[model samples]
Target: MPRLPDDFDDDTDGFDPDHPLADQPALAAVARFARMLETIPWFSRVGDRLDADDRAAAEDYLSALGFPGAAVVPVGDWYEAADCAEALDMHSLSWEEEEHLRAVAHETALEITDEEALDVALSHVAHQAASLVGPAAVLSMRVGGLDDEALARAAAGYAVQACHQAALVLAAGLGAEHPFALKFRLYERGRWPVSITGESFNLF
Candidate 1:
């Protein structure tokens, strides 16, 4: 639940915090890319602490090659609602899904008790997993004209993938293991279109 800076969403006259960095084009580009990567759950939660050290190493390496004075600047929390909206658009998610994800992101961001955060996040993951199953079944049926047994396998596979993605995101955000992560890990070594019912089927 990383909160963007207070001024980040204030779009009065298009004031962007990182806009001034344009004066230093190279650093500005690096900063923009770095900040975007930092928005990734695992990186922001667990990997960000090493950013300064990584930068120092990069500078040292550059200086060894006769390049010097590569300054590192603090990018701060620059993620915004617009950024989330755009990401949802890229994923082809509905507006309702976008809003729900945003809420889940914010909830994970709060500095609340660990138990509370884990509880809430896990519940969200459960609901998301359940919601994916029917859509998965429907899509497989429509596109492949699969029978019930094959449809079930396709649906289960879809649910597993969706849950895995959600679990990874929430787990990184919470800095803890998610139930869906465990489920996905167990199935990771298995073939795709895993069986949901007792029937064997080929996805082909």
Candidate 2:
């Protein structure tokens, strides 16, 4: 499984070990405009090496980017609890779903003998594919009502325009096949609703 860095200095190539870059007046102004593109190992050889904090960061960043129901976490032999969600304009996920995803990832570790440990790592990728972006405000099973328009198909992710650009970046990284990617790729197509404060966004 992928482990999240305690610090973000692992790859200084301007790569987001956590989430995608947003149009921030500063990191604060851009708090809810971030986007995270999950990789698919089934399609290629990507989606590994991240931790819970990384997940939290990704979620927080995605929320900042206006993604509904986005959650971030750190991957490890065991996943860690993310602490920067509120500051990033996001909320934390529920322990149940968090535990569930970790367990699912860990169970799949048997096939990864050639590689190091990979349950939490694989979960990060799978969780994204199985996850519902607009379905809750945070970790809730409820749809956050985020529409496809926010995804910006013209950008990175799924939409028609992003297929070759953003999607390719993930394809080459996780080393998964295109079909596998299609399952989890986020769509930024149409319009949607907005979320208010004091809401609990947990995934079932």
Top-TM-score structure, candidate number = 1
Structural similarity to truth (TM-score) of each candidate: 0.28, 0.21
Give candidate 1 misplaced runs (Cα > 4 Å). Answer: 1-113, 149-154, 157-165, 173-204
Reference-based lDDT, each prediction = 0.34, 0.26
Model 1: clashing residue pairs? 1-108, 1-109
Candidate 1 global CA lDDT score: 0.34
The residue-by-residue lDDT of candidate 1 on 56-150, one tens digit each, is: 44334224323344343222211221122123332322224434544564455343324454455445554545554445444544443334554
Query: What lDDT score is found at residue 8 in candidate 2?
Result: 17
Model 1: lowest-lDDT 10 consecutive positions: 195-204
Candidate 2: C-alpha lDDT: 0.26
